[model samples]
Target: MKRTLVFGDIHGGLKALIQLLEKIDYSKNDRFIFLGDYVDGWSESKQLIDFLIELSQKQECIFIKGNHDAWCQEWLENDVVNDIWFLHGGKSTIESYKGIDSSHKEKHLEFFNEMKDYFVDENNNLFIHAGFSSMHGPEKEHYKTNYSWDRTLWEMALTMDERIQKDSLLYPKRLLLFNEIYIGHTPTLHYNVEIPMQGCNVWNIDTGAGFYGKLSCIDIESKEFWQSDVLQTLYPNEKGRNK
Candidate 1:
C-alpha cells in the first residue's frame, strides 16, 4: 500500500528531516514529494541532499525545485554565487561541502539538475516549490522558473473569501483546473502557524523549518501530518531565523 507524502522546505535541517521521517514511520512503499529548499539554513545541506538521493532509490520521489535550489543550480552550473544566496542561507550550504569530493559534488548537481519546476498528479493536484501564474498555467510563455518563485497563487489563497464561490473568470484559472495545490516557499509560520495550512484549495506546507519553525510532512490523501522539533533546537550552535 503505497502512500503519498509531501514534505516542506528542509533548508539543511538534516536532523529535523530525519526526525520527521521517523515520526511518520516511513516505509519503502511510500511515495514522497519534497517541496524543495532542501539546502541552505542549517549546516548539513550536502548531507541532506545525499540522503534524499539515496532515498529516491528505495522509494518513489518527486523533487520540486525551489528558489534556493535555483541559486544552488546557478552556483553549480556557472560558479556564480550571488550575495542574495548567501544572505538567504547559501553560505552554510557552501560551507557544508567545503572539501567534498568532486564526484560527490557532481552527483548532487545531477540531482539538482533533474528537479522539476512543478508537478501535477493524475488527480490534478499541483505541487510546486513556490506559486505559479494565476492568469495562466505552466503552459504560459513566462519564465518557467516562476513556477518555483511565484507567490501570487498562495497570495490569492491567503486573501480570498473562501465563502464566495470561486469564479473561474474571477479567480486564477490555474487554480480552478486543479483539485488542490501544494506549495512550500512561504513558511506557514509567517502566518503564525507551525503546521500545514489550507486556504481555499491551496495548502501551504512550508512551516518555516528553514528558520525558527519545524519541518512538516503531510499525507495528501489523509491530511495526516508529522513535524520535526523546533529547527533551532536541532542546530543549537547555529543562528537560524535570527541570522
Candidate 2:
C-alpha cells in the first residue's frame, strides 16, 4: 500500500531536511505532506525551497502554508519584510538570497503563493501548518488564513486530560470532524519532547527543527517516524531561532 508521510516545520534547515529524507529512504510511491514554514531560521531557506521543488516532480507532495511562509510571501511580493518576521527568522532568508538573481527568486515566490492553508484527505484526515478554529470547520469560507495560524485547536488538545480522550462528548466537535489531524508550528520541544507528540486525535510533529530539536517525519498510516539530528548539529555555525 502507498504511504502518506508528513513533515513538520523546516525553518530552512536544509541539511537536516535532506538527512531526514535519506533516513526514511523516501520512495516515489510515498505521498508527502509538508507542514510549511519551509523558509526562515536556518541559512538554507533558498536551498530548501529548491529541494522541495525538485522533490515534488518525483513524488506526490502537498505543501501547507505557515505564518512564517506568509511573512516570507509578503516580503517576496512587496519587498518589505515585516519587522516581526525579520526578528523571528526572515533575516536569514534575506541574507541567503543576497546577490542571488531574480529568476530563482520568482520561482520561490511562486512556490509560496501556491501553498495551501490546509489539506483534507479522502479519509477526512486534516493536515495543516497550524491549528484551525474549532468553532468553524475547515470548510467554512471566511478568513481562511486562520487555518494556518490558529493555535486554539492544538491548545485544546495539549491541555485536554488524557482521561477525556475516549469521551466523545467531551472533545470538541470540530476536532472530531476528522479521523486524524496533523499540525506543525508549535514545536513539540516546548513540551520537552524531541519526538512527534500525540494528544487526543491531534499530532504535533514540529520537533523544533528551527531550534535545538530535530526535523521530524512520520508515516500517517503506521505512525513510524524519522528525525534528523539537532538543528545545531546540522547548522553549527548558525544560531537559528534559538538565539
Query: For each candidate, what is the lDDT?
Result: 0.87, 0.89
Model 2, residue 24: C-alpha shift (Å) = 0.5
Q: Which ten residues in a row have the lowest lDDT in candidate 1?
A: 132-141
Task: Report the C-alpha lDDT of model 1 over 1-243, residue by residue, as the tens digit.
Answer: 778899999999999988988899878888899999998899999899999999999889999999898898788778788898988899988888888787987998999999998898988898989887746677662778777788888888888866667764566566687899999999887789989999888999999988899999999999999999999998999986456
The model with the greatest lDDT is: 2
Q: Which stretches of candidate 2 lie over 4 Å from their true place?
A: 165-168
Q: What TM-score does each of the candidates earn?
A: 0.95, 0.95
For candidate 2, give the lDDT of residue 123: 92
Question: Alpha-carbon error at 115 in model 1, in Å?
Answer: 0.5
Candidate 1: residue 240 lDDT (0-100): 61
Indicate the residue-level lDDT of 201 in model 1.
Answer: 88
The per-residue C-alpha lDDT of model 2 at residue 114 equals 89
Root-mean-square deviation of each candidate, in angstroms? 1.4, 1.5
